[model samples]
Target: MADTWTAIDFETANQDRGSACAVGLVRVVDGRPVERHSTLIRPPDPVRHFSHHNVAVHGITAADVAHAPAWDAVWRRILDFADGGALVAHNAPFDMGVVRRACAHTGLGHPAIDYACTLALSRRTWRALADHRLPTVCAHIGHRVTRHHRADADAEAAARIMIAAMSEHGTTSLAELSRAAGLRLGRLDAVTAPTPVAAPSPVGPAADRFDHWRRAAETPMPQACPDADPSGPLFGRTVCLSGDLAAMDKPEAWRRVAEAGGHPARNVTRTTDVLVVGSHAGVGKTAKHRRAETYRERGQRIDIITEAELLSRLGMTGA
Candidate 1:
């Protein structure tokens, strides 16, 4: 946890994690941030179903990227900016997933990233804060941030918060502060840029099946948040994930949910807190999760995240 690194934020098209359409980078060296970069990346998939909610956030649209470079085109720049540094973000695994998808698409070697999450660091450093959300945290620290969902502004704000935290905590060097922030690089590759993954035939049974589901229904809200307050939707509860978070690593992201006074349960049952669905989720488990259905039908509290949207939710936007 003792290294200077770059922080990144990705905004995706709609709700797909694999659909990173824009990225931002902030490089911090010697505890002072330098080198901010951002670019719109065209996902291989067209950004259909663009949401008003999302458009309000990042301001990206099909029109904006009518002729932009694909994710394949701009990934090298992202990798280069991240060179020789641990990748820092609010949610480490989410950004890593987007990076993984970009790698998978290009057939490139997945780059190793040392990680430091402001999300995790917030819990460690700011025990008095009400919420660790970017804007909330920034407001608590008295930093004026305008855009709530853009990638660059958020990344810069995160970088500033990191700098302030280090100063407040009195960590003289990047290494010292990094360790305190839980910066960890496990078996990370030393290379700056990786060879791209070869193109997959964007056509296949899995792709077709997944597409069919998207084309069929209005793409149902995946699953509900899955926690019900006697009064409202998980207003003041805790939800946890154990075993596996499936894809996008639920435990890592949901750590914030738990820290926020939402209790996360290790086991699923009648008394279980919430069920976070992962890629490894099974229909049998769904069948067993009758609680989810019951709550959904009654308009209680429920939440589910697809692997990709989970990653997207974790993506930090300056917007």
Candidate 2:
């Protein structure tokens, strides 16, 4: 609760974090909303396409933002409106990620700001609630968000939620509210576009060791479990594995697939029906992953999913 702060919400055109198609902001002064601002943005070239899922969520189509200002232009206005004040958002990480990633793509300097998450605050203050989603929290505190996905309405709702949380905790400032709720105010440090770096080639013994490790990581195909549940999601599906799964190794993953009545293959062949890709951030796609995509492009009905999705389908999420 610095005398002034901005509450923000961003709608992305696609899954990419930098694809900010619209933004809503509400500025609060002395615990009261003083200004409301919103704009539709044309996402940068690299991630400008609107996905059907995203459109369904926010109801903002490509036609809606065809003539809108680009991210850099809107970002400047956002900074001007904030006037160096802290930011508050329902989920600060997502909105702030949009800021950082969009800035990186455009080579614009990232904003250095302190921020608070009304969502986190609500979770801590109203721990008894079944869920701490924005709409749920707002409804709990009697703040009606008539337009759920609209940027302006969401920003306003977040602002009001923060105000209510402050009152609930009997705290006059952000610091006080954070301490009372046993949470910490998050910060966004100043950042700029990163320089590309080429990976160094391993030499001599290191290269040999790397090759050995790579070969050792590739697990042999497991035989399908004859007694596995036939009604399972993976039943009768030919599943392939790729990348490093968080919970288990490749052998465990293949075994689980077999346990679910799936035929686990060592590679993505013509018969492969599903490719379970694991978490491999900041790395190039694995050979199996690329093969699956190629087959899909050629009209193969291949399902590409993540490790979490695989576990969920197998009814072993926490396993």
Candidate 3:
């Protein structure tokens, strides 16, 4: 809801957050988008392989960005385009992750830009929608995202959605809008390295719990419950996890997966059927997630879902 801010989106060449292939930015001034910019980028070295799934999503193949400028070459232009305004993005974490990881990979300094997620804001604004995906939210607010995956179109759609949310709530500023929505403005520096599960101290009850959790996460694939409902969403699926879940520890999540008749694996594999992506808000995808994308690119049927979706599938919507 800032009078002047930027809505941004990035399309990746593959699963690596650093593998940015395209970027789009829309600058909104005084509640209206007054400028737009987009560019194709050659992803950083060693992570530039264009996966088939990613290409199909945005239709940007390696050939398309074969001659494009790399992240280091275009990052300054992107920063200048934003003009010191906070960024807004549909899934701000992913887009921001792209920026952070790309910077780290290219040895560029982080741009210290704060951002807000339209996806999160839309959830607070329109709670009745069955799903709060970009396209669905856009449609609800009458902002038709004709080109869903294209970076430019998605950026524009996110901008419009933010505008609509601000108007709907009668909020005149980003802070006000965020307060109304019960969320905080996210910044890139807010993201931290993954917190490793603690090692047991062998002396206290907390240590015992930690030990149990550590084993659960490190356990080999467990047998599914025979009494589990066969028609359940996760039934018969091979599920793997990535990142840290805010709802529950990995052990609890894995136990629930097994109880729901899903085979909970310790890692992503060709045979894995679903990758449940968890949240450490502002954190990026994990190696398992990247591997899952690779498998999907190779035509494997794997669903990379959010922890909320996983809970929904496990019939634990609010648990």
Give me the overall lDDT of model 3. 0.76
Query: After superposition on all CA atoms, what RMSD does each candidate show versus the true structure?
Result: 9.4, 14.5, 14.2
**Poorest lDDT segment (10 consecutive residues) of candidate 1:** 221-230
Clashing pairs in 2: 1-174
Candidate 2 C-alpha lDDT tens digits along 1-319: 2578899999887655678999999999878899999999998777677766577778998899999999889999999999998899875766886787787767788657988877667766887875566777788999898998888998998999999998998877777887898766778888766432222122222246455335435546767755443445687899987866655445546766775568988779999999998756457888888999999999999999988788666543222
**Model 3 per-residue lDDT at 214:** 68
* Candidate 3 structure quality by residue, lDDT tens digits, 98-145: 787777677677546888888667767887877667877878988888
Candidate-wise lDDT, in order: 0.57, 0.76, 0.76
- Best-to-worst ranking by lDDT: 2, 3, 1
For each candidate, give its TM-score against the true structure.
0.63, 0.63, 0.64
Clashing pairs in 3: none
What digit string (tens of lDDT, one per residue) describes model 1 on residues 31-92?
Answer: 88878998777775533334454566678987887677887667778768878677776655
C-alpha lDDT (0 to 100) for residue 19 of candidate 2: 81
Identify the runs in model 1 with alpha carbons over 4 angstroms from their true place: 1-3, 46-53, 181-268, 275-319
lDDT of 2: 0.76
